[model samples]
Structure formats: structure tokens, C-alpha cells
Target: MSTIIYPAPIFGPVHSRRLGVSLGINLLPGDGKFCTFDCIYCECGYNKDFRPKQKVQTREAVREALEKRLAEMKENGPFPDVLTFAGNGEPTANPYFPEIIEDTLALRDKYFPNAKVSVLSNATLIHNPKVFAALNKVDNNILKLDTVDMDYIRTVDRPTGHYEVENIIEGLKAFKGNLIIQTIFMKGTTEDGKDVDNTSDKYVLPWLEVVKQINPRQVMIYTIDRETPDQKLKKATKEELDRIARLVEEAGIKASASY
Candidate 1:
């Protein structure tokens, strides 16, 4: 199946289920994927399948492109609800990410002060001091934490480099309720017949414990919405998602489920 590949620097003002009318800021190359994790459910497919031919857009270029887009939007009819840092890869992976966030905030203030700046990160680079600081600056510092199980993460999320869930949790706690926890819950079997379901109490309960420890401002629990590279993977049911959300609410934290 064909996968979604976004343009470089900037792409959409597409309607987002969670963020409303959104403008995307793609810091990675437009041609392919450059993420730290090779998730089976990623709409962008695997990293090796789509190696980027072009270099990551420079901070200056991103600023210029965003300014142009915001300018057009300001003159045109539909104003953006949020300026989102998302695309084919991890936005924080860009070398100039911190600088770009600073630029984005300045431009947002200039063009649409009402529009929120959001970043969708895998949470791998949150350990980096610069990335951590930059994320704190954004309106929505959305970080992914699928499960606490390391085997599941390695088999499913497939981190490219060194990744310790304990280390990540420590970094997340540093945010101290300023961040949002985004988790993707899905159920299905992989090509090799291993079960990929993570919506069970085993995963959910453990993940919830971590979320409580991190104590994020909110939790976004979502399922597969688009076609994945691994066709064997399936969407987590609405019932399962809602059940998990209810559990989060019971813990006195806000939760939103997107089925």
C-alpha cells in the first residue's frame, strides 16, 4: 500500500481530529522518512523503505516557509487553529529544531497570535537539553509512550538507537505536568504471527502508572487511522480506547480518545 509523504518545511492546513484546522511544519526531507522509531503502524512506512534523498530543511528555510504560509493564511480566509510540527519524521530530530521552535513562536505571534504551536515527538530526543527546552516552549509538547514493555517497544515501535524506557520516563517527569502524553493503542497480529495487541490491561495498566508518575497535563489515546506499512496490524477498538480513557479519568487526569 502507498504511504503518506509530506512536503519539506511546510505542508498542510489540514483538519486535525485532535487539534482542529492545523498547519504542518515538516522539518525532515519531503521525499521520505527519518524517524528514530520504525513503528509498524506508521503511515509513513519503514525507514529503510523510504530513505531520504534530500537534506533536512534548514532552520532559516523552515522559518521562511512558515512565514510565507502564515502570510497567505492571514490574507486568505481560513485561519489556522494550530501550527503543528509534524510530518514524515521526528521533528525534534532536525539539528536546528530548537532554533526552529523559537522562529515558529515568533512568527505565530506576528501572524496569528491565537494559533497554538504544537510538536509531535517520539520522546527519544527529549533527553537532549536543547530539545527538552524547545518542547517546553511549544503550546503542546505531545510525546509518545505506547507501552512500558521493552520487548513490545523493540518489536513494534522499533527504536533505531539506544532507548531506555526508564530514562525516557525520567525525562518526561522533568516536564512536571507541562507536557501531553500521546499513546497509540492497537490490536492485531504481525506478519510473523506474533500478537501485537497493546490495549490489554497488562499494557494499559502499566502505561497508566507511568503517565501518573509523569503527571502530564493531558493524555491523547488514539488508534490507527490511516493505512500502515504492516497490513497485518489492526486498529484498536473504540470500546478498548474508551475503557482506557475512563481509567485515565479515574486517575484524575484528562484523557481524550480518538478511534
Candidate 2:
């Protein structure tokens, strides 16, 4: 079984392949994983493996913790390049996400005005008007979109309930030019030995069409960088990622591949 990745709420000015020098802000409860999607590639492990007794952090607590970390980083030098909302689970699931984003913005302004504020969301809660509004205020409103195929999504992302791929794609489109779409391209099988691959043109073409519709500022193409819930899964090579990125570029969208 894969271990829990992030057990703390506020952790590290860690080096990120996508967002440089990131300070993670986990909006979920400190002791467990809670998310709308149970993706096979999730580095934090399968959702069923996590259930914590701790409660979600209050807005005040988040504010206080962020302020303390920012102050410490400022005094010590090497201020973070980005304050990212990402960890064990969904940030927006906290119910106070709008208010948290507001606090983070203010704190970012106070500490590192030039640094970017990003959210590494699964894009599950964007239907909420408050969440949508708050996401717009960030420097990088990164949203996941592995493939446009619903079957592929169901196999990998496994969004809870009757959640549809079209719904997520449309919601991301509503972001207009404010969105940064992130894709994790890979080919392999699930733990059950089920074949699941999205690295082919069959998946990439339609996915690019959705990207064109969304017309985001940037498209982040990456592969599994750490161990995932599905051991049978294989990571996409940097070259394959670049090839897919070239297609996005051809469609007049900016892109980057992180292997």
C-alpha cells in the first residue's frame, strides 16, 4: 500500500517541477486524505486508506499559520516562489475555501508581493460561485484535466458521484483566460490488471480540442513523479510529454512538460 504523502497542513518551501519553491497550504484536516476524486496516479495514496479523527482547520488558524510561515521565510531569506494550496486532499472541500483564498492573498501581498499564489485543485468544486470567484484572484489557477475521455477519467481520476467529464471541462472553460490546465499523461494498467493508457493520439487529440476551447494561459503536461496507488502504472517519458506539448503549442497554446 502507498503511504500518505502530506500529513501536515503547512509544509515546506519545497522545490516543485511545475511551481518553483512552493509553500504548500493544505486545507484538509491534518490527519487524513479527503478528496472528490480517487485517482489511481495520486501520490498521496488511495482515498479509502485515509480517514482522520482531526477536524478541518478554521479560517483563523489557516491565516495565523500562513502569516507565521511567511514571516519566518521573509526574515530567513529565499522567500517562496509560490504559495500553493495543495496537500493530502482537496483544498476547496474545506467549505471555507473562498475565505482562505482571501486570507492567503492578503498574506501573500504582505510577505512576497511578487511571488505567485497558486492552487493545485482537482477542479471538483469549481461549480460553486464562491470557489470560482476566489480562483480568479490567484496568480495560477491550476486545474487537472488528464484526458477528455470519460471512460479514461472514470478509470483514473474516478470523480465521486455522477460527476461528468464534460461538466469539469465546461467549468474550466468558464474560467476564460484565467486557467492553467494540468495534465498527467501516462500509460499502463491498474492494480486489478486493467489496461489504462491516455498517452496515445486517441486521447491527446480530443483533449487538445478541449484545451483549445478553454484557451488557458498555459497547459502543464506531466507524468507520475512519485509512487502512486496503482503500482502497475507507468510514467510518461519527458520526450513523450514534449511531443504532446508540441501538439498543444501547434494549436496556439503555451505548454510545459515535467517528467
Candidate 3:
């Protein structure tokens, strides 16, 4: 199966469907993937399929690369709308992630102060105090919450290590409306022939309840856009995504749907 393995430290001034003109900040190695979760839908593919020989990028390397990229962008054109920490694997998994965030913020201020700094994390490591603090500092702390059901999680998300949805919800609550909740709604069957449609009320309602409890600034509901590792999976229809977005909107929260 085809997959994307992004270069470490910095990449792109690529247009993002959600964030817009995003400058990617990849903390994981360029060669392969390293993540806490092994979601079937991941564009980077399964962890076992693409293992990195190189270690995670260091704090200094991240800072330097980001600075260089920012300088070039400043000198040329296509200024970034957001410096996004999303590529390959989980950004917070990097040992120097917090420090890198600090560096990124400083550089952003020096170059594009108006631009936002965003991190796309799986919400698995928020239990770590340092990771929590770092997330709090960013302009957009976007955390993934596909569903609350453990069965669904195991079937689709398939967390590699210890991951409890209850714990994740609590950690999200601790954010106190500072974070953005990103959810993927899809319709499909896993390779094992088990159904995996999460757009239904069975998944949406319970997930929405937790979203309300978390009280995030916004909820980004999206379907599969690019090619996923799992060929059996299908994108959630625009109508279904809209319905969920409306539910979130009705709850007095801002919601965006990307089909």
C-alpha cells in the first residue's frame, strides 16, 4: 500500500483543508513512522510497515530547521497561516517536543507573530505534565477523539500502547476549552469483516457528549480525504459529516466539516 513519510523537523507550506497554508513541523524521523497508536486510517501507514532507523529529531535540529524555513518564507512569499505539528507519527512522542514548541513559538513571534501555532496530537500523551503544558501554550491544541467506544477504537484506531478513552476525556477536560477536538467519521468494514461505521448516533452521541464535557473551543469533524492504509475503509459522506457538525453546533460549540 502507498503511504506518505514526511521529512523530519520541517516540511511544506502546503495548503491544509482545515488550517490553511500550513507549514508542517514533523518531529518524527523522515525515514518512517513512530506513533503510540496504530490507526488503520493513518496516511503514514501502520507502524510495523515503516519503522525508522534514525532517531526522532532533536530539539536543536527542529529549531534550526524551523528557523531556516521561516527565514526563507519571510524572504520569498506564501507566508504560512499556521505552523502545524503534524506529520508521520505523534508529535508529542518526541522526547524534546515541549522544548521544540517553545523554540517554534519564539521563532514564530520573531517572524510571523500573527500566524497560529498548532499541534495535532492523538491525546494519548496529555497525561504527561510536560506535554499538557506544551499543548496549552500553542494557539491550536488539536487532539483526536475518533470515538469513545473501546471496541471501535480497537477495531479502527488500534492503540499500540496503553490508551483509555476515559483517561483521554479527563485529560481533555483539564484543557478547559483551550483545545480543539478533531474526529474522523467513516463507514466501512475492517479486513476481518466487522462493520466500522462510526457516523451513526451510536458513535456520534456518546462522542458528542464527551466533546460537550471537554468543552473545546471548536470541533473539527471530517471524513477520510486521502488514501488510507486500510483499503476496506470508506469515507463518511458529506451529509453524515454535516449532521454531526450540526449536533456539535446545537451544543453551542463551533464546528467545521471537511469532506
Candidate 4:
């Protein structure tokens, strides 16, 4: 069976197990996709050979669309539970990310007071002071940290030249107790067909160190539910996820698994 793909600026008020009835706000280009990491498990498909030419949507454009959608939804009776900043790629990569957050907050207050503003970032741009400040403002600051081991991180996330695992972890630590760390667990084959699984003690031990350092409010542990570009990839079982969650909680951190 073919995988379901949702592509558009305001694609869905879809049911999300984590976020719940989210009204998606895609900051990246509608036609073109731009991302810092080119992971094998990307649901948007693998990053293309050429760089995305189109720029991210402006703050005004995002705000206007959100306001209009909220107004329409209100009149229609039921509205989304959250206004999620998720799209083709990393939402924080936009240069005007802070301004966008500010505008979204304002719009949320005005139109849908009950709705919360959430951002799904790769945590690559958290190293930037401005980006960090912006992320701190959101109701749900969902940041990704797949692994802490440099070799495993490189193999899993496949981040760009500018991004360093140490730098990303440092940025995350700077957030202290204010953030939510999201880890997507998977057992897959690398592009070259090498076995990739971080559930083992050796791979997860380093990640636990980072978790202790950051001390986030919550740690979301989940495995792949959708088709990825790499056909050889396999999803981790519920029992495996539960075991990892137990380890995380044993370390005095809150963990939730989505199997």
C-alpha cells in the first residue's frame, strides 16, 4: 500500500495522537521543500538533489491565513485544538521565526483563545539566540533530538554541514526544564543497508546523558507509523518502546510512548 502524504500550507485539522486536532501551519514553501536534515525516515520523502528555491512564507502571510482559517472554523462551530507549526520541513528555519511566533500568539489570543500555539522544530536552529527565544514563547515547544552519539546521530538524522550534535545538545541543555524533547525511535537499514537500531544500551546510554543534562518537562518516545523513503526500515514494537520509556522514567524523567 502507498503511504498517505499531506502537502500544503494549511493541509489538515487532522487527528494527532500527540497534538490533537491540529491546524497545521506550513512555514516552508507549498511547492518546494527545504530542510536542514535529510533523514532516511522522512515522511515528506527524501530531500531532493537541488536546494529548495522558494523562500519560507512571511509572517504576515502566515498570520493572515491563520486568522482567516480560525474565523471560518469558529463560524462553522468546531475549531482545532492546537495551531501547529509543522509543514514540509523545519518551521524554525524561517528567518522571521520569532516574528511568526509573535504573530501566531497574537492571532491565537484574538481569534481562538482556547487554541494553543505549537512548533515542531528539528532543534538545529536552537543554537541561534533569536530562535531559542522564539521557541520559548510557544505553548508546545516540540524539539527533536534523535540521539546524542555523534556517529548514530549522523547516521539517523543526516543533518547538514552547519549542524553539530554537540552544539544541538548544548542548545537543548540551555532550554533547561522548559522544553519537550521528542525522539523518533526506529530500527532501520542505512542507505547502504547497514543495520540501524538505537534501542540497545550502547546507543541509548549517551542519549540518557543528554536527557539528564537537559531535564525537559516531558520526553516523547515514538516509532514510525507511516511509510518512509527507506523500504528496508522497520518500526520498533510496542514492548520495545515501553522498555525505553521505563528506562527514561527510572532516570526521573517523564516519558510517553506512541506505538
> What CA root-mean-square deviation does each model show from the true structure?
0.6, 1.1, 0.6, 1.8
| Candidate 2, residue 160: how far the Cα is off, in Å | 1.9
Provide the lDDT at 230 for model 4: 78
**3 against 4, candidate with superior lDDT:** 3
* Tens-digit lDDT track of model 2 for 1-259: 6565674569888899988999999888777788899998888888888776788778998999889989999999678999999998888888888999999999999889999999998898899999999999999999988888888888889987668888888899999879999999988899887778788889899999989999999999999888887889998877888899999999999999998
Q: Please estimate how well model 3 matches the true structure, expressed as its whole-model Cα lDDT.
A: 0.94
Model 4: pairs clashing at backbone N, Cα or C within 3 Å: none
Give the per-residue Cα lDDT of candidate 3 at 184: 94
* lDDT: worst 10-residue window of model 2: 1-10
Q: For residues 1-259, could you state the per-residue lDDT of candidate 3 as single tens digits?
A: 8899998878898999999999999999999999999999999999999999999999899999999989999999789999999998999999999999999999999999999999999999999999999999999999999999999999899999988889999999999999999999999988889899998888889999989999999999898888889999999998999999999999999999999
Cα lDDT tens digits for candidate 4, 38-125: 7778877766743466667888887788788888988994688998988778888888889988988998898888888888889988
The collision pairs in model 2 are none
Please report the TM-score between candidate 1 and the true structure: 0.99
CA error at residue 130 for candidate 2, angstroms: 0.3
